[model samples]
Target chain A: MTVGTKHTHLTYPDIDEAVDDDVRQHMEGMMEAEKGVLQAREQEMEECECKEGMFPNPTPGRRAFLLGAAAVAASTLPRGASASSGKAPAGAIEFDVPDDPTKVQGRLTNDDGGYGTRSQFESEARWRFPTKTKETSWTMTPLAESEGIITPSGLHFERHHGGIPTIDPKKHSLIVHGMCDNPKKYSMDDIRKFPSVSRQYFIECSGNGLTEFKAPFLKTVQGTHGLTSTSEWTGVMLSTILNEVGVQDGAAWILAEGADAAVMTRSVPLDKAWDDAMLIYAQNGEAMRPEQGYPLRVFLPGWEGNTHIKWLRRLEISDKPFMTREETSKYTDVVKDGKARQFSFTMEAKSVITFPSGEMKLPKPGFYEITGLAWSGRGKVRQVEVTTDGGKTWLIASLEGPIQSLCHTRFRIPWMWDGNPALIASRCIDETGYVQPTIAEINDVRGLNGHPKFASIYHLNGIMAWTIGADGTVTNAAHKV
Target chain B: MLIHWSKTVILAGSLVAFIAAAPASAQKFNFGTTPSAEEIAKIDIDAMPDGRGLPPGSGTPAMGKNIYANSCAACHGVNLEGVSAAGGAALVGGRGSIGTPKTKKTVESYWPYASTLFDYVRRAMPFDKPGSLSNDEIYAVSAYILNKGKIIGDKDVMNAKTLPKVDMPNKDGFIPDPRPDVFNYR
Candidate 1:
């Protein structure tokens, strides 16, 4: 049952036989060897950090007058007798450096007894949208960097009012009161008693790309349009719950509220609730993660994300709407003509190119895969057109999946960058024949009054453009005339 | 031409019947499915843009100042200035900035209607404790904020009748949407 002596070849049985003298010695020796390797790696990393300025300029033709350049070169050189060995070039050294700082000590043994940490090399964090109130704000998913449709629960973006609260599910209960024959209270377990269903859908913030209305406001796709994400949600139909509670005559609206510090509330029309709304308890086939509302959240398909109240605690049915603060002071569209348009609930169709986008460089720029995401609240994206030289001409990009209605669809195009300056952008057309409008078109419809609050400019779904320079630098370009 | 003639004959016949029955239908003012006064009273808690939904309760500016200080001062600020340093929205004194570069819309200067303040607060306010304030408290706070902003006199009592009558400084600031025009598409 003795384990292997080598670090890479270490097996599990060694721990059980650790009492044996031979096995104990082998385990001790392996630990010492791993520690030595880790220490040496740390020293090498410190040296690299000290001489980071000494590295050869990756950006060709830049002035290389940095004082640490020599140190950077020396530290990067190969280590040990391998440098003198005939196998490699003279002065060449091979350093076994780990890809991430967390992995420097190597993989943990099975009995490590702790949660795993993400690699230090991963620089992703929750993308936040600047807001008027810190307690009530939103964060977005890193959709462009993600490989699949299922947003990782930890990486699931959040929109909260009054901040996130820690709720004990045992003590929490959802009360279906007002305008019902049988006002009922259901615990988390009571909700699970109904017939369960699972479906994948995308929830998009109405203000997903609000910042980019004027221009490209963020450098990364996560910052620009990360407010939308898709997840396989498991739950019972709200209609089924309503049926059990027995809706009374003349019921029109239901006031849904969260138990967060803000007690966020919204008035949802009953017709939509009976159609496709779900009281979700699980996300991505697992128990709901804390950020995705741990215990439960309401899911209203094809509607704005705010109405899908997370950490749901109550539902009060009434003949009229509550006109909550979120729905009034916020969310309502203020037009240019001194009029505020209320009840604007749907998020329009939109698309954006993620790869070769801002803050990226085209490495030699030949044939590259131009990839991005397209989605529509009205229905499936009928087509996505890419314009290589801005809006003058466009070609239809290939859609990659069985286009689902009201879902995020990945689109790709085989683009050849000819080492010349070019402007790239994508436009989406939904099943409803509603073309994604330009910034001017949206402004014309919404109108701008110059006042930041009443500017009617929050939900901007215009086409986004990125410019690639001849020198391989990519920048967010303004919409060309 | 034959089909057109036939359709006209049928329309004429129907119009004659409708004219004949119009008087009978108009004899009674049918407010369709008029709920009992008691039933209506139970659910008519909405605050309208015209102050149509204000409840029977009333609040004065003096009482409202104390209530706001206790419940809302933490986030909204004492002068209703909003916590600008902490990034909270300014709730008062941004009156003439609309259509200008430095517009700071607040209750005193920017809101188009006073009814909105009552509606928004009755349903959601105090940030931490929504739907917890009484109708009188909501009315008083609305009066205090409006009076402080100089929109109304200190003695003014905000009730269903007075709220809609109070004129907002930026009442005419909003403009209609002009889209799908040559300016938008091109």
Candidate 2:
């Protein structure tokens, strides 16, 4: 099951060997492809079976449910009295109840041991952008549901040009060629053998808040700011590999290509490669997920997500940019004068309030802790400002938890709600001294040449505001400055 | 980690540490094998704007007509207008659309270099079956698309030299990214 001495021709024998014997047998019986084996393994992870009556799907709107329950209690029950008559209330366990905690017997340890499952209500999921095809679609990480800077590996956001490729680590080889003394190909095992280093960084899509260009189009923070996720990536530094191959003089850019269906390519700056660029094969604590480029991928901190080419198969160093279709026709930002901005790689500082955000209820708004995530690709967030009255006045929010460069930082501010309607928003200032601008401000500069509104959707790191209704409902405050 | 050493002692110790770490870092962590030329050529399909990696083949628009109709038209339209369901973008027209309200980005109007088309088609094309086109087919398709967009003559042949020479319409429509563009200087 080791990376070395395994299959080296895109076969899944090594992967099958690593998987459970029973699962492998089941997969083999079905004559599934390598992707099927991995998918089966995923299915096995979610094999928590429960009786139908035990956990019926909860109704959709939390506000409506809570408000309805409160109304029923006020109308039927005496003030400050319990809803129950000292017996088990409705929806409570009707079967034999074990009152003594020490005597109560939990589910016996079954054959399947050591695997875990999240509590039903504590489940985190990525929401997919509704596109025509799944192959070219993207899914947003639930930033609102995340606890700290590190996004759970399973809940990380995904953006694919030709869908996720089921690459066999044994078959994969990263070729370092073009403008080098030695053009060598490193196998998965060979790559692991190199002096490796791990560092936590955030990869954010330049189009993170594109939908909120003219207005707060998305209903939730996940939709507006979920295109970012942090991970402790482990791999050999790009400079180490470049030095190993002897990077030739005059080499300025490296054309990175993936092995996916699209063969996704981008021209990365050589300086960044020498600085902190990584040829990461492991994410979080294990091998990268298939969607995140299973076998290998290149990660450039403080750069756009597309530049971190996944399923990285080749590197061609050259003096100039390749100007591939990705850099020109796609990722380029078209502004005024009909001229497009090319190689606009860096994602600036941005922040968004997640708690008490859109579509959520304030149940009994008294002293609620308003919190959200803030990050800057340029560097660590220096400060975060929150405004409960739109942008009329802003107060510095306390940044909590670990603070790392190019990593998402959690910020919280204690807000006292007057129970009346109010507007809420947050903005970040990065260490580079760049402050997050408003949507109007961004458009003013880009549209100086009279470009239409929402013309350029990439890199819209504008402030987002949520309007809280008196009836305990929160919604997007579109066109808010 | 540097608590005990005095200023001069720390400087000397740091110098020693740097010297000690230098050779270890310089020592080759050699783990990969140098690929043979043949092996390298198998996947090195990037074509530079200056016609660096064009393959040894050529094709004309006449030769590419049938190939385009059979393989590319279903997604990229028979006239290269682009089919939405296929996710193929319109390959031609959109001339003079930049800076205007209705800016239509197409191969004829938006692409700055012609070699990019040859490179992209060879690497990924036909929507469903990419990397399936031959070198000659790629050249022929490039010629056909360019001709259809009126960027080149109908009978022109596309090759390493000719393809790079075919000046795209919007060659100067791009500008370098000027960052910190917003008025939020720290």
Candidate 3:
């Protein structure tokens, strides 16, 4: 079907098209009113075969499904909103579901043109941080609604310097030059020919919980610490490529540059490159998403997400750190001595109870899983300590198996909340013996800069406390502490 | 028959030599091609703090004013005050505000090297239209921001040599993080 020509508004009422229209409107500085939705509804009605179907029983086909879906939407949503509101999610599709699933034959295998979309009802998304522009913004994964350690590739948090670029693998090539003897450039096909390794790693923005530093600024756990995500990234080890390029003597640092509009650059230590870095082409068993740097990206395992340049196009080895805009002014931390800390790479051990996290209502609290994501950029999370009494006493939480180093480890503990007020929190202890400190403890050293208390925004791995109220409502206890 | 046997021996000998030299040279997997000079020039835009990789063009604040007004000032204010609605960071003031409550992270207060400004602008600036500025225009705009921030004089021209030489005020403000600053572990 032809899309809107004059306005380029969505002519189709599919979820992805609707989302694009919303983003397009947002980019044009137009707040979305119902004008576009109304136009969409009119177009949708013309294509819709609902006139062929009746209420309780009609032809068991697409027409009947649309009628049923509309009924469900009208009942579930507010006064004016209906199915033609067309806001399911970006990746979901309009599927025809029967009123009775057991009576009908299932959809044929490979019926969806060899690929499929998620259920329209299961609409969990990475909510974008309200930055002024969409180009240089970040999105937070719905961590509270998350399950398991491996964050679904679609739900992975993204931080884009410039907007995501659509790059073809055939056209894209990575040039490994400067301070290297060979100065070689590898295409995607060339790089794929080498023996590659797939390993799970979590990339956390050092500024993950920048809002929760001084006080609890945001309400949800997603708002507090949703800038981190884990995926089984697949690629040749950077050392393998480095070997092929042949590093010269005195090559201390390497500048990783992206192919995006910003051409994002960061100087990473050569040691880190040799240790665990990967020139990743695939993530979670598939090619990387455009938002996650399609075709190629430099994965500096466990480093700040910024240092892990997306859409990575160049690796220029150098003798000294190139004090780029990212390293020098932006990501540096202001410390206690009236000085700033630069190149603080490691995201220290951190954990939080996501189930009983902020803004979640514990319905008549009985047996609830006090679970959340625990991770350490330093190494594997050895133990996660859970505290329900405001850090007074701690208990060891059980970590779900397959705890990969530098990856998100899901930890769970059974909590019998007695419908009484309780402060629940979790702290991680990595293999390095570094325990995640309390917000107050973190503030004591890093928070107090001889002036009044305004905390440094990066590397906030402090224990996040969520207070369970007597009425079975969980809220942020960061401010209280 | 005799010629084939000699050729086989030479191939085997060369294979052995290739295996021996693997560690010393870059022959592992034997992948990738050497990028041409023009291809390298298109993307090799990073500038080192020691004035390396900088082009020869020079510019002054006066030369930069028109460029900044036309392209940059829409986002980064006309007077470098920063348009908050546009997400442009103020490059001028906030001289001694790092550790204070009113820490404003302007270039004057935070960025260590003047070369960073030149490199960043030339590679990625004007926010919306990155890499659109010429090296001369970038040098000029860098000088304009620096001049407004009180890092450079009105008359000083910014080339590769002079840009690196301009001592940023906060050069000594940054220190290496000696952390895991907290030791209490359970």
Candidate 4:
């Protein structure tokens, strides 16, 4: 009762020592008076004085129940007021379990006071790509944690010609000039007013698989093949814009330009522009993320990603492409005999096993689900074959649904491990019935110019193999059988 | 809570006031200003293979020797041969290695256009410093290299007019792509 004093009847010692002698005596006296009153009430019940709905039989075990109830009540009394008063010792505090367990112990406040931070343990992947200049280099996405076909907008990979421009969409306009019957400029709003459509597709860099040409160059699948990504883009088709502008006859090519510091530009053929090209303004169901060209960009399905210009500003119709520096000096592939191959656009069929890939180690040999992504710019992936025994035998993998053309098709195969070392690889076959070739076969056809040039080795859609060692270390086994 | 409502209203009002007070011109975004022809003419020294963009300038090979000594000799050696100076790429010789494995194609050997030499140098050159040379200096250097390679005479004096007319050895070397045929895959 006094919070700290031990009574002769009570067995447990009270932890608090702040209560004085007077408070202890007062609590003990109150307990004694309550006991006396209870005894008198029992005597009266024995004399046949009963209340309504009370048997008043004066059972012998009833006193024990009353004593237990009184002990519980005594412990429930508030003695930790001093704790809230800030007078308790540094380490003597104890938390009480509330009568209602659903109640939260504390309130959280944020800058808006309505939002709260996620649990401290939760984390998301951060981008880590080197930069030579803001415009030229690229940053990779963490593909391992990506779910479904949509890459989370924040983690989308980036490749810019000039630095990212902070363009205010209100003032931005795209001019369709040159070989058009009536050259017209459309503001961002005007362009969006046209009939809009959405489709899921994958944009692959022409140099996506270049590093894997000679050998397994990068450790992670993201590093080796992250240049390819799938997104649901919403936009008005370039055909619709060209229809409004009324393209003139004999216009072979159109030059597209961006509003960045570099004023990046590229030449695209008119046929492709009128066919499947999209002047995209939205990605993954939202306004385009800044890294994916915030306001608007060109989305050419099944074409090289660079040709899908970002921060789009101008489109000039012409009979011949204005061969900008990007086309002539950079993207053009110098072949084996000093002849450079230009306009090599399509990214060929390729696939790589993402799970159990390089840098991953198996904890113990058991049943493992071998999963990966396969895609073809030519058409939909018809079939994916997994070679568990290094191409000696191949089995068709189960292709997941939503296999649209020019999109990444997910493939999975259940593989068993007997704890022995083995080589694993995947090969994709396109709808065109063209099988993805091996490194040797590709090089034999495209003649490796001893000097590495972008043109000679632009498309390296070769089979990627991963070797699991006896110790369970996985490595990019390019040549090791 | 009542005070908090008043504060929120005041903040929203200020934001609306600020946006309303902003100028209409400030709201419109312009990619870039259209530079005047005079201003652009100062920097548009791009020389096409036919010398389309070359400015009015002329230089003899004798004067080029001195200019080349001061400007081009550092990266390209004094004899017009390339230097192996760590970062500098080779600039001369290696002409007929186009189809061979030991090809070392350079300006003297591989370049198909004399005007390209003038164009490239005027736009981006002098490894450490780009766009620093005058049009006359670029023309003089172009003449010196062409005379050394025996493609042009010392008195040809390359300007906008003469630079385009200079005949290059491999001018007809390149052919348009005729592919997607049965032979392309084979």
Best by DockQ: 3
- Please tell me which model should have the higher lDDT, number 2 or number 4: 2
Q: Given candidate 1, what's the lDDT at residue A239?
A: 86
Question: Per-residue lDDT of B1-186 in model 4, one digit per residue for the tens?
Answer: 999999999999997897689763243222223334454344333344545556888886877888888877886778777554322345566566553444444566556667667766664565446567787888898898888878889787878888878786645444333222112110
State every prediction's TM-score relative to the real structure: 0.71, 0.82, 0.84, 0.65
TM-score of 3: 0.84
lDDT for residue B75 in candidate 3, whole number 0-100: 85
Model 4 RMSD to the real structure? 23.9
Native contacts, share recovered per candidate: 0.14, 0.63, 0.74, 0.05
- Misplaced by over 4 Å in model 2 are A1-104, A108-114, A448-454, B1-25
Pairs that collide in candidate 4 are A171-B29, A333-A455
Of 2 and 3, the candidate ahead on lDDT is 3
lDDT of 4 at A163: 58
lDDT of 3 by residue, B54-170 (tens): 888999998989998999898888898877678777788878877876566788888999888988887777777788888999999888888888888999999988888998988
DockQ for the candidate 4 complex?
0.04
Model 4 lDDT tens row, A1-481: 0001001121212323333333334334323432343344345334332222111123322332344334434565343111122121122232222233244333223332453333211222323333323345565555544455666666577787555779899988777776765566777888888769999898877766555555554555666677778888999888877776667888999878776655566779999998899999998887997778768899889887889888888777777755454554445554545665567677778787876676455655788888888898878999999987878899999999878899988899999977788899998988877677777676655565523321244666778888877655566776442
Indicate whether candidate 2 or candidate 4 has the larger DockQ.
Answer: 2
What is candidate 1's DockQ?
0.08
The structural similarity of chain B in model 2 to the true chain B, as TM-score, is 0.87
Clashes of each: 13, 3, 0, 2
Show model 3 residue runs off by greater than 4 Å.
A1-87, A448-454, A479-481, B1-27
* All candidates in order of DockQ, best leading: 3, 2, 1, 4
The numbered model that scores best in lDDT is 3
The ten-residue window of minimal lDDT in model 3 chain A covers A52-61
TM-score of 2: 0.82
